[model samples]
Each structure stands twice: as structure tokens, then as C-alpha cells.
Target: MRRSRKGQPVTEIFKQLLCFFLHGTSRHLVFFDTLAKDAGYAAVIESESTSMLSSHSVKRFFRSFRWPRIYLFRHLLQRMFLWRLKLEAPDVVILGIDTMVMDNDEAKVRHGVRPTYKRVKGF
Candidate 1:
């Protein structure tokens, strides 16, 4: 007998996430309504059904997710970057880690303006 409550396959869910990141609109929405309406996302996922990508489902996906998965994904991204550097034989590979900062629109950004080691004078 089928399970009491079946959910969408993991692969399908991941594909949806990937599509959203690649083609979603700039405007921020809790449920990513703009992302769901993306033409590229629709084609890649092989479905144009809004019900399949409902706001509740999207919110549930984020709510039920674990941090360890995100850590693992970050490691994978770094590994890919290193692999590409090796293949291309770059003279130097400078890795930059960025920290998220909350500030007003007047903030100025310049080359080497905000290094990881140096902290901003004013908060």
C-alpha cells in the first residue's frame, strides 16, 4: 500500500531550488512567487504548474531544512572552485570570504575596502 502521506521527490525539490536561484526575480518574497513564475524555472523543472510550487510548500521546504545540509553545500562549492583553478592553471587563487552587513544605501565600496581581518570603524 502507498504511504499515508507522500511528498515530492528530493531530486525534484532540489531542481526547483536550483532553478529559483538561477532565474528568480530580484524582489524578495517569503514564498518566492516571482521565482515560481520564471520561464527558465518552468522549463527546467519540466512543469508549469503553480500548485506544484505553492507558497506553503516553499515555506515548508525552508522551515524543515537543516543547517548541516547548507554547510555541506558550501564545502562542495569550494571544492568545485579549487578543481576549476587547478584545471585552468591560474597563477594565483585568492579566496575571499564575505560577511553580510546591514547598512544604509549610502555605503561606499572600493577595492580592498573591507577585508576580512579589518573591521569597520563605525557600526
Candidate 2:
């Protein structure tokens, strides 16, 4: 038996996730509205059928929710999965490390803009 009685169902974050993956269209308020309407969010929720968010809200959500966390998670997962599968390989010819001076930044960078060093305190 399905449990009942709640103030309202939570707004569907899962749909937003699926919407991004399956459709691959980034959301504007209009886009989300159209998607929700086509996917029958209009029929399901009488109140919020107009726009899933304001354009400002959509921008905020994209910056806040979608990109920062999920994108990082996906990259980490992809790297780990590739490593596990041994599918990752260095694209360039390999070199043996002799010693010192990573040359993390090349000469093209400004002289004042030295690479950030993890300083220990008081040498």
C-alpha cells in the first residue's frame, strides 16, 4: 500500500537530472516550462505549470546546483572508472623524472606571477 498524506510532493530534482542527461538541452525558464509541459508536469502540478523557474532562478540553479557539484562528480567518476578499466593512457611520449624543477609555469607567464608555493614558515 502506498503511504499517503503530505503537504505536497517535493519538486522533482530527478526530472531535472534526467532532463539534462536524456535531452541534453540546458534550461532556460521557457525551456524548462516547455519540457515540463511536454513531460506532463503541467498536468501533474496545477500551480507551477507556468515556468519551472524564473530565468534568474534558472541561471542561479545552473550555477549553484547543476554545474559545480554534478559536473565534478561525473569527472571524478569517469577518471576512476577509466583507471579501473585501464583505459587511460598518457597521450605523449613518456619521460623519466631525474630531479627537481617542475617548471610548472613556462617563461611566457609574467615574471611577478610566480607559481604559488606551499610555504612552511620561517626558514
Candidate 3:
């Protein structure tokens, strides 16, 4: 299990693997399996995996944790991403924001799907 800077367990790093299969987006399982096998396709930055990552194990684990903490989790993710942006403020020439909506028609995806900026009274 991986951990955040605050030493909190980051289970979603694995759920990312779950979302690949359980969500029925694309041929996620085939893609995952193919990539897991072909060591030559691995990048220099990628350390070798000891064993293949199992989607079923992930599904079982996800059932235990996928509830009630999205508010906290999303904030934690945003804070980490913002911190990275501050540290690596690249040159303006190649800087851009790319918002990707994955393989779904998401017309009414969620309540906060639209971009909004609001000031809160307290930190």
C-alpha cells in the first residue's frame, strides 16, 4: 500500500486500477493484462512489478473503502496537485490545462461537474 506525505494510506491508487475494469469503459482488462506482460513496453521511469496487479483483488478491496470520504479525499488530492504545480511552474510557452472527460457521455455526471470558483469563509 502506498502512503501520502501525511502518512495516510492512499487506497485510491489501487482503485484507479479497479475503475479500469469495473467501470465498463473500454477493454480495460485486456489493456491492463497486455501492458502488465510486455516488459519491453515499460518506460525507464517504471520500476518492475513483482507480480501482476489483480482487478478482482482490487474490486474486493474497493468494496471496503469506497464510501463517505470523497470530500476529504478530493481535497487531499487537490492540495497535493497544487503543491506540485507550485514546485514545477514550467515556462508559459508549453503550459496548458487539459480537462479530459473519459469514455462516458456524462451529460449530468454529477452536481459539481461544472467548473466553479467560490470563496469559503474559513480555511
In order, candidate lDDTs are 0.61, 0.50, 0.49
lDDT of 2 by residue, 23-112 (tens): 656643557545554536544443455444334444544565556678887999988977855765656545597754344343454546
Question: Which whole-number lDDT from 0 to 100 does residue 26 have in model 3?
Answer: 64
TM-score of 2: 0.31
Superposition error at 102 for model 2 (Å): 35
Model 2 misplacement above 4 A: 1-11, 24-29, 38-56, 65-71, 83-123
* Residue 16, candidate 2: alpha-carbon lDDT: 53
Per-residue lDDT tens digits for candidate 3, residues 28-52, read: 4456555456565333224244334
Model 1 regions more than 4 Å off = 1-5, 30-45, 48-51, 92-123
RMSD of each: 7.5, 12.5, 11.6
lDDT of 3: 0.49
Error of 2 at 49 (Å): 6.7
Scored by TM-score, the top model is: 1
